[model samples]
Target chain A: MTAPDDTLLLIEDLTVSYGAVEAVRGIDLTVRRGEIVTLLGANGAGKSSTLNAIVGLAPRKARRMEFSGSDLQGVPPETVVRRGLTLVPEGRRVFSSLTVDENLMLGGAKHATRGDPAAVKADMLERFPILAERLHQNAGSLSGGEQQMLAIARALMSSPDLLLLDEPSLGLAPQVVDQIFDLIGSLRERGLTILLVEQNVAQSLEIADRGYVLANGRIELQGSAEELRASPEIQDAYLGA
Target chain B: MDIFLQQLLNALSLGGTYALLALGLAVVFSIIGLINFAHGELMTVTGYAICFALIWGLPFPLAVIAGLSVAMVAAFLMERVAFRPVRGASGTTLLLTSFAVSAILRVLFQNLISARPIPVSIPASLSGVLTVGPLHLGMIQLISIIVTLVMLLGLNLFLHRTMAGRAMRAAAEDFAVLRLMGLRANSVVATAFVISGLLAGVAGLLWVAQRGSVDPLMGALPVLKAFIAAIIGGLGSLSGAVAGGFLLGFIEVILQAYLPESLLPYRDAFAILVVIAVLLFRPQGLLARKTLVKL
Candidate 1:
């Protein structure tokens, strides 16, 4: 599908390599404004690399990589974040020593061009009551699901226009996974665009407006969620039909 | 009782100096995993700055300000010139870089300034004794204790209260994650160095006041002691550094007070023994938090 003018992130012929190995080999992707786009792939399929490359975490080369109509190539990771693209890195790399409140505070510490940090923190606390209950407790003390929530809440604290979630449901309990997916859906409803990378194929497909299937560091397929869900190739490979 | 009170005050004051220097070391180490052996040189820099300021006819307070300012600027330059180029290299490389910087600065001071210890005269009031009830307190000791506590309190508030400080704390845990939070790595690491420099300034002043002289190698013994204190308290942990410093001070002063005069010459040996015993028992230092692996 042609990218609409409202596209928030645009990537064309993007390549990510670490030394001799290429993780993402020349793939084009787009995330339009206010849409949930899931980039789904199996292990070693360059899913994480794609997300990392977007934020300048990985060595990347691209013909065009734009976020909010601005070139993202060569921008430092921190500057990319200030440009309103925040990543909840794989494994929810929260400052475990810091208390929940401190994590949220650090998240909003550089809330570039956003509302008052105090207000953003209050909004996060209100949305994630569990985080509020354990505001003073170290983030390490939290369970996997709770830490994930705190990680997402912390990302939201930045008030980013585009939120990149990398395997938010990884290592979470099944019920907790449901809660995270629900949270992602709710965030989209609140007008925050998300580019999700997940291994949970079925659930991601359910919530994603469009889906891209990556294989061996390249896009193998791309279509609407409904069409991909109905496709024989998806059902045979992933849906267990 | 009076003797005990005197020793207690001495311990507090001495411990305060160690705490200040150790916390300085810990601050830099925690954020970037660099065991900056040159941290002692920062003290040396401050001491020389103060000495030069005095020689140049500046008032004591103004000299102190000049000393601290030079130390801060020196620290900034140290990072930008030496450390930044070798950043992200192995820990050993960073440690070696610090040693090289230390040696270079010391040689420069020895050749250009004076190889001999430069005596810095202070007001008589700073050297006088204070009588509080039945106890006598050395002026230097009292000031050291007070300044150490105040600096600790200020640092504590900065870490817990300010965004920059919180960013430092976070960077200590996960640097990449800190960048993802929209804070620059250069700024955070630079801030750590500047804070450490300020701490070294306070600590160097105290050390110089007690000695009445500043030498090129004056920082050597105190910084070594501070390093041991930081390790005993848990190297990267700030509170641990303070606790370790105080503990080391108490051990040294108590040893001096209680040991036979003949054994006093070997006091540091006994202190080392105590540190060895503590490490044998805890291994992780007294206050290091176990890093939990995320599943």
Candidate 2:
């Protein structure tokens, strides 16, 4: 929950605006190696905005934004990807018309060595058996939870050091949501530093090492999962306790 | 029957040209999601570049290479200056910009040469005929059909099997997600325009060889037909574009054979009607394109 020496992602005073509308107002956050940092909020709480801004998908004027010692300030999305930061965008943005195999093939294009994409694909299928079952089927026809799993597996295909997942559980059955959280929890165990943004605060905290509560484009509360879970403010807003 | 064979050859030749040009258009469309209005001008740019190469005392093959290369440079410049920055600017803005790019390129060529069509002298080597079984195919038509088939096959292989091709397909499916693949969007788009110019240039050459003339406005028909063919084939699929082109070409030539003299004059109109039918019914085109996830 608290790491003193090793920091994987550090963002300080990040401000994002769309035209005159400010989406994120000067938020600071950190995620250490092998940690799952969850940003939780309702719709329009800037959770997605903060996650996106970290990867430069959102245009936020940040005073300091660094990932694994690299300045991700002006890098375009693809460059950000090659730098080992991958975002599984909201709504599982897989190429629907592409076959499951083709989607995975495109996922590995970022690597310097086009390493056996087939092997990576095999690994991905092993992790998500539903995808393996539908290997030849068009990606668009997959069920919502399966689509989300594919999205995560596709991101993993890039072998990213830090994975940003936005709303992976927004539209799925409760069982699927639990499966996704378990998957995220296991990914953290595998040494993947993750920035998970979700509306499901309690579920996210259950998996997250550290958690940040975002409201009105600012970090309303931040602490270890247990601290945040125990906080009276969060309990009142999120847990219904 | 001899004439029917000739017209069948005619239909294939026309189809080849249409497919090549439509491919160029489809490349841009799939990569950037722009129905590039200037793509026609890129074809015109091809024509004018060929005219220039001939004027400069270059050999025909060399002239064609130079023409295609110049067209690619022109296309690249257009993307870097005009298309890329405003790429996400909206369909209307892109449409207007593409038209403007086309108009500007057309005018530049006109002012550089003349305001009229220029005759492209075909080398004596390319002028001949071949007799095969029941059909006698002109060298021009035969060569056009062969080259076009080869190009289409090559494009198909490149798109499905090769890295760059799959990247193009990936870009077509989701340009934003392509960033996750660590491939630059600009490079993918530039590849599209480059291929577009190359094929369009080849089409310009085959067209000139067949017609024995080149004009600044020569690209108008092929461009229009390819776009229509692409729409008919299913707006963004490569094979569909080719299928649509051949279908349109066959339909046009066959109508000429079967229709009354008055209706023969409306061949272009008839071709457009086929496109309209496709749009009205199979809006996803021949292949039925599908998206991956909305939620």
Candidate 3:
């Protein structure tokens, strides 16, 4: 657990809706500096919606929402990214027509305000060797696993302080999933904070510092990773015997 | 052979102008998915500016600059007053809004100026023919082709090498995702419109030079042909739009040059028939790639 002053993101009673259909009801969550917090839920459990609201992609209302000591009320998504928070949206939404290099270039566009994009791009290419090999190829032509790596690498181009990842392993082979989770663990080891939304509950809890389980737009359980992993309710509902 | 060479030059010049116009429309379409029927009015605005500048005895180059500037301003205004308010509306709404803007501008020009064609004076040096080795070439035709080529090269570099240009391309692919990249949507949209206006201005200048006159309705045919070119090229592809423009120009020029006198009267109809045939064969367009829409 982190001290109150060290909290990187603080949200209270956050609600998201699509017209009259409430996707995420009032929920409070917090993440401190250098913590990996996993949000686990089934389809339509509003895990994605919570992440979307945090990044300002969805219409959201909250009693209070702050990131890095700044208010996020009505802040646009782009501004949210500029403020050192970025989202790697579900399904690896790479710009299909653009080249891998070009997609990475766009990811670092916000970094232009504060850092050297060329240096960051070189770092990304080095980190994701597969992306470097296919730098000039169209993003759509990349394999699913490669695309996922590119998506994660693209988000890192911004040098975000807190990363929001939605379903990073939504569709990958077991080995690829292992590789992705390894990458996530490595990212945390490098001192970056992450708020992860995943349906792979067991794998997610294995690496998460803390876990929250949401059902029907509300958080049904919240505890340290060890506590959630040992809970009978979590075992029967999410983990198979 | 000399006559053939002359016709080839004519076709190239006409094709360059059409390509420019089509490319302008394509740029806007790729970004906002708006066909911008009012894009033609931008040409009309430039045409009138050129007329006024020349009538005031300004130099031809100055007149061209004035025309381009006015067209750019008109484009900005159109986006601000008309299109911006309706951003994210359905395709039908945007299309009808652009049509409304077009109609209102045409009527405004008509009521403000004269409905009659106003003659424009080009320097003798520009309109005169240059002779070289058994072939005669119009100076304006050579200039238009060279200018269009240079503009296209510059645009290609901008789109490929620059960050803003990359942002625009990404916006075309997924606008919502682009916003998450921390780019101002308004700036990207404005850049697209500015480039569109610049192309319209230059193409309009070349077109008016060829016709030797300006009128409120002057934009009607060129815009219609450019729109057809955009459709034929694959509505949202930049290079496709250029290819479509050249193809349309080639069909029009070829039919005019070689058709029997009896068939010459149906030249426009024949050109459109060719376009329809092409569309029938490749419905997405000549250069269109499949786009994946995310859930």
Candidate 4:
């Protein structure tokens, strides 16, 4: 475990619930700066709930939740984005009705008050050339892989210090998934801290510096990526080895 | 032929007013997914303001401005006070809340002022008719059409070019995602109400000009027609509302013009029958696109 001082994001005793149903229960985790941390889980393991809670999308309570030393209690989702934490939501919730360019522009809207949105947009277009090619086209017209790319590019337009990605590889073809994982690896190389929630355990572990397995609203396992890959339980449950 | 042209112009002018009212309702509906039935009360409130302004010896333009301002303020208050509390409630609940609000406003107007019609003097310039070549047109009709056109153009530019306008459109798509872009929920919803109010105010002015009087219940029929227009256009589409309004206006005018004198009294009933027929054919409405509600 990283020291508390070095931790960029720290969550202590966090819980999330929807009405009477508890989705996440008393989880503690930390992501130090510039690390790709993966949360591995099954469909109902509360992975999405954890990410949603951090960004204020889900009902949550925590003993201590801080990002870069700033307390995150009662902060709204927009403020969370403004504070340099951006989430690429599940199923690539790209604004399908809007043009590709408009989606990118909206992504940069949060930073528009503080920085040059035009510059950020230009950078995103350069980074995701496919988005540039289809700038005038509606986002819905894009193929699944392309839409996924647009979703990531849109989040990057905010220039967030930390990126929370939920199921980036949910329904993509194998080759497209490989491309997305490579993109994730490259983003890490650029020093963006990432909290990745994924079902593709093997690929996530390959890029993740650390991994946590969640089951039934609790963290079942936590270790470095190599240790997780070698574990017999992980092999049996996720890898099918 | 000249009489036919005159009737067409008249129909177009009436259509313009209905279009404005429908557009207002559609704007509010698109953003919050609430069919704000009290939208008509905005017209009622504006009509009262105009009457009071004229009573105070204010000039016609100033009276119109007063009416517009009052309607805008009322719209903002409606959202902040009545609608905001019940936001995210069931569709039936929202509809009932707006209906209750409409009833309250009507009652307030009746008790505070007069239940009877209050005569409003139209400026002579507006009341006059203009004849050019073979065509004749009422100045008020011309002004109403022109104003509606200008307002529509302005609204189009705002929605297409401005950031706030884009945010409003995005809110229709997924309001939560819009918040993730760092927009304040209050500001976006408030903006929708403001626009709705402005449209209602202008429509009210035209409506009063045509009727030559204002009463506590003056907004009821026009608002109902506007609701029909919005439904015909597609509940959540702005352009559809305008199109639907114009279509409804044309249908009413045509029925009134062409129907025998004996059948003139049943024109409104016939118009509703036509709307019902159209709905039977296109249940989702004329321009109904599939809009996915986000989870």
lDDT of 1 by residue, B138-251 (tens): 888899999999999999999988989899888878888888888888999999999999999899998888888898898888889999999999989889999999999999
- Chain A vs native chain A, TM-score per candidate: 0.97, 0.95, 0.97, 0.96
**Candidate achieving higher lDDT, 1 or 4:** 1
lDDT per residue for candidate 2 within B1-295, as digits (tens), equals 8778778888899888888887788778877777776777777777767777888899888988887898788778888899888987878888788888877767876788777878877888788888888787788888999999899888888887887888888788778777777777778888888888788878877887888776667777778888888888887777787888888888788777777998888977887786788778887888646664544
Model 3, span A1-241: residue lDDT tens:
2329989999999999999999889999999899999999889999999999998889899999999989998998888999999999998889888999988888888543346888889988888899999999989888788888988988888889999999999878889899999999999999999999998999899999998999999999999999999999999998986
Count: clashes, candidate 2: 3
For model 4, what is the C-alpha lDDT against the true structure? 0.89
How well does model 3 score by local distance difference test? Answer: 0.89
Which candidate's DockQ is highest? 1
Off by over 4 Å in 4: A1-3, A110-114, B1-7, B132-135, B260-262, B291-295
What DockQ do you compute for every candidate structure? Answer: 0.56, 0.54, 0.48, 0.39
Poorest lDDT segment (10 consecutive residues) of candidate 3 chain B: B286-295
Write down the worst ten-residue block by lDDT for model 3 chain A. A108-117
Pairs of colliding residues, candidate 4: none
lDDT of each: 0.91, 0.82, 0.89, 0.89
What value does the lDDT take at residue B55 in candidate 2?
86
Q: Rate residue B183 of model 4 by lDDT.
A: 73
- Tens-digit lDDT track of model 1 for A93-141: 8888889999998888854526689889988989999999999999998
Q: Could you give candidate 2's per-residue lDDT for residues A1-241 as a string of tens digits?
A: 2324688888889999988999899998998989998998879989888877776677878777888888889888888887888899998888887777777777876452134666877888888888989988888988888888888888888888899999999888899899999999889888889999988989988888899989999999999999999999989988999
